[model samples]
Target: MAGEVGKPNGSGGLGFKGSQIPHIKFTKLFINGEFVDAVRGRTFETIDPRTGEVIAMIAEGDKEDVDLAVKAAREAFDHGRWPRMSGYERSRILMKFADLIDENIEELAALDTVDAGKLFSWGKTVDIPHGAALLRYYAGAADKIHGEVLKMSGEYQGITLLEPIGVVGAIIPWNFPTNILFMKLAPALAAGCTIIIKPAEQTPLSALFYANLAKQAGIPDGVVNVITGYGPTAGAAICSHMDIDSVSFTGSTEVGRLVMQAAAASNLKTVSLELGGKSPIIIFNDADVDKAAELALLGVVHNKGEICVASSRVFVQEGIYEELEKKLVEKAKAWTVGDPFDPTTNHGPQVDKKQFEKILSYIEHGKVEGATLLTGGKPVGTKGYYIQPTIFADVKDDMTIARDEIFGPVMALMKFKTVEEAIQRANSTRYGLAAGIVTKDLNIANTVSRSIRAGIIWINCYFAFDSDCPYGGYKGSGFGRDLGLDALHKYLQVKSVVTPIYNSPWL
Candidate 1:
């Protein structure tokens, strides 16, 4: 709190807005469950995408730092008292951690909004709060991890024991840093696994800040460590570290592949990747145009369309394509794109300048591929890297816009003739993280949901997520589910304990 600094508003006016809130500076790294300076004593500045100005300076962690953190985590997993604690006791501590997160939600949300340019309403009201809820849920789940008593045929008895998998490395993406980090960490922690967290460099402030809160929450030293640096360096180090027992990564498919390769090369660590998605949203003629348009807009345009399952590819029935397109275009235009601090602003700038350029390039590609630009083709505002919410029509299945994960505020609308064709087009992409279908017909909705080869199927809804639900995808979208009791299995190992009742007879 002492190093916090407030940013100026869009008018460059150092007025009430700037005075109300402040930016933050994180100059130390969290390792061994403590805030300490990096051993190498190096640091880097995090730039604000809106102003292209250095907002905060963070501890720059490299391979040496990664090793130190991993060693601490390994020591905790092997020799520390955490793994030896009762499941109930561990659950109590995790509940405490969740309470701490809720207590400091405002501070954490402010930091996230400043660092990542996400909407404060979302970060404060939704992301941080849900993150805490997940932690609490996992906390309650910790003690409830049950083993089985299996019946044996011979003179022997068998039982299965659920045990921790040891040190885990969780690499989270920039878009939803706190939410995703908590999603991975809560279950791993509840399962008695120590962790080394590598947050996206574009938005590392909140992750590091949350580490401080973890210490305050009674989590033991070395139980949770955060290293803030680029993916290729700190992230790669995490993946390849021999001491790490497993790796859980959420990022682009290309980078996800590297993470897997690194894990395989180092120790063949158990890896769970939640990679990219070219999620599709299909709208049928029977669907309500206004409702479909609303869900469609939320699918791609929400969170600046930076979500992995953004529903970048939208499939509309030809009977209602023109009507739906009009509604979608109008709905998109209604969303205000401006500074995240503005309470009324619906869309915010991309994470950084580079991502802004990449999104622009994709829009250009849409134009080149003959996808008629329906609305929003250019960047908005002069100060920040804000892009206008874009939508394209006449898109073919082969178009690059329809095939690739744009990871921006560009929605490519394609028309399909029949329900079968819609299902086929939705599942055509290499990714299958999520999909949405809008229809009033129960049979059509049920059929389409069953046919889509994605992890989550939304009916007349988009961007719906809950801590209790299972999430993750098949194919290029990556493997391993996150959230709910099912996620707990990923961080635990099943061991069969067998005993011979008639040892004398066998001998």
Candidate 2:
């Protein structure tokens, strides 16, 4: 599916469902509300994961490039109309921005479908639309930002001001490009903060498209900027830049630590991170075995198991362990893996070749650790980065596959003798991002939900996410929250004002 951009079924373009590829534009660095080339005149190739071919050449932004973006954001936050504008005005512009997104949803979805290897159907139906919804949600919240007056003990009056934390730097992941991009960007804009976004280089195409739409929506110059580059260069510059007031990152825990350290060593800027996970989905004896198996299968297999909260660790009670395992194997074997544009394809290739090799290595680790390979454990097709929906049984808590975040289509099935055992095993991992509890008995669900140390728990289901719900991690999965009002606060700071009650000192 590689051919020229405008030419159908020709060289350098990726055709989906026999349709021509969307025109690629705005591949330059977005700074000060304009598309410009990098200072160093450097460029990098963004590959199509579906075919492992170069899709387009993106402007490579490194330290010098990040400096330019940060400088623009800083100026905008300090003196531009964006920060000083009324919340209602900002809300109006954001609504317009979201509308533009809706109008061009097809092109944006198509860019992600080829560049990131995301399913085209899901991108149109859920991922891109959810981004628009999130913007609207935060737009509605813009005007409602307020602070409460405080009562003082010693004849003094007090109040707190919730103000924008200037110059945010958001580093988003590749797996869910459209969804996670807005997940970090929406609230920051709604809070009246200027931002510089460093999208994952593996999926930089869609971010560039959004930058164009931001300009079209009449967002002020320098209010939103995007730098498409590698993590070690552009991502590091965002974290350590002294002008950036706060940083929000969504990626691996290893990179999360680097962000924190850079922020601390430079200016001690505020940091919020949503990192990796080794989530567990506990299916007990009381639950329907077949239903639990399907949920567990989809939980890990969705996005080719590239989600941060993929429930790769499955713990089933002994009474239903064999049945659930059998069902998991059968369903995983039948799961479809193919082109993202194909209507019948439920799973696509990994984001890039590096991720593909990483997942395959972890599968090897699972075998070396003595876990039984129940079904599908190898790469699929001849080209691209496709892998079979792999499953392993009798997996122990300490096994490599169960311990690490593979971020691929792999599941580790384990047996738990009792409820206590399930809780213990689930909490064994260093990550506590998310978990699932499946049971017919309300008592078991309630008990396990409270017992788990993770940030969010789902009952009788998996991958249940919403905009209003605050989502974050409790342990090594990283800190701070995205979504809800909690996410808005990450881009805001508080200033308390105090005065004498009877008569102010100046008065």
Candidate 3:
């Protein structure tokens, strides 16, 4: 790596001051495994969300660049040697790629934290490792892809084959760029599909870094291309480009809709959207108070609550409502917040000024709606766009904070009397990405897991994840799974072939 960056471990806090971090220039787009300038030579500055200072100047790619990337991917998919390789060979290369990611975990994590304002520990422990593991998981699944022979009434032989879906457009979100990119990219590559990735403008550095790493890993040029620019320009171009075979997007529901619309207008390509969520977490009276409180805080306050499946709404049983509220407030206030480069910081600033203002506005809205502000309703520091971890009490299901997706460190607390009421309130949201239940009773766990409409349910835990498990949601949270063997299947198409055996009695 040409640039050396420092990563945070668990130590001091991530602090911020208003000063420019020297601009790191990145003017080229990665297309056909080579770095080249944009056609129009346009570029934009990427600001550090923590200090509001421009840290990098990135290429501003558009339709022409998108066209170049798609053509390259299509050429690779149609005539390249990648798909012709044996499954075992593909698996070996992917495993090596995963190992390469492990070797650069600290560097990648540092880049992600600086660019996205995600907590250092989050990037190091959760995001980077999981991303590497996802690649390995998909690598293992490469050879496991099975085909079947079928018996036919006629004197013929029948078989089924799984083949790659041509060139793919992977549109990733800003929150967890490196993590989600591999979640989509690894599987697509393992299944023999060529790719064109359009990473979110706010945090495109890490994805570009990985694109370079793909080149080093001997992934043929054009097998994986990454273009960085605004969603309306580069992103929309990728979605609607006729040469692209499919689109996999992870972002807000509104943008996902736009992607779907663009796909319809052009190729009518296969699309998988992993969108927004107004997820919920339920705390039953019988649960362990301390553990529940800790997990509950992590559910929404961790990562500054910038996750798509963040449990923003909390429903506490009436019996332990007051106790849990007190515990939650005390624990939430002490969560260390500052620079992502600081090892001790538990939370970092929101991604940028817009998100910071958005979180503050929601905090104000919560106060105006008559919800009792238990703690933290203002920005914590003067330098960066930092907001105090906020909790709202006496919250009703009808409140905007409870009904809508506020992608911030604001938690809404409501009371529920019975299991039925809890389930009903939990299922009320238009979004159903994930839900958490804290209870000791096995029956309650089973019942709530089945009752909640979310795709992933956590029993006595929150935000638990594994690369081997499928993760996604229902309703407005969007369709399609992103992890596990299922994600690889999304990149494949099934075909049936029939042939005559000996040409005996039938003739």
TM-score winner: 2
Off by over 4 Å in 1: 1-25, 503-507
lDDT agreement of model 3 with the native:
0.85
Backbone clashes, each candidate? 3, 6, 7
Model 3 bad stretches (over 4 Å): 1-27, 153-156, 501-507
| Model 3, span 341-458: residue lDDT tens | 7778888989989889988998889899999999888887788788888999989889889988889999999889999999999999899899999999999989999999998999
Candidate that scores best on lDDT: 2
Ranked candidates, highest TM-score first: 2, 1, 3
The C-alpha stretches of model 2 lying farther than 4 A from their native spots are 1-20, 503-507
lDDT of each: 0.85, 0.89, 0.85
Clashing pairs in 3: 9-343, 11-343, 11-344, 14-338, 14-339, 15-339, 32-222
- Evaluated against the true structure, the overall lDDT of model 1 is 0.85
Error at 70, model 2, angstroms: 1.1
Residue-wise lDDT of candidate 2 within 110-201, one digit each (tens)?
98888888888898899999999999999999998888798877788899999999999999899988889998899999999999999999
Which pairs of residues collide in model 2? 3-10, 3-11, 3-12, 3-13, 4-11, 4-13
Residue-wise C-alpha lDDT for candidate 1, range 1-507, written one tens digit per residue: 122212211111112243133535344667886566667777777767666677666778899999989999999999997887888999988888888888877777876777778888888799999988998899888888878998788877889999999999999999998889998999999999999999988888888767777777788989999898888889999999998999999999999899989988989999998999999999999989999998988889888999998988888889998899999999988889988877888988898998999999999999998999989979987877899999999988898888888899999888889988888878888999999989999999999899999999988888788888999998999999998888999999999999988754553
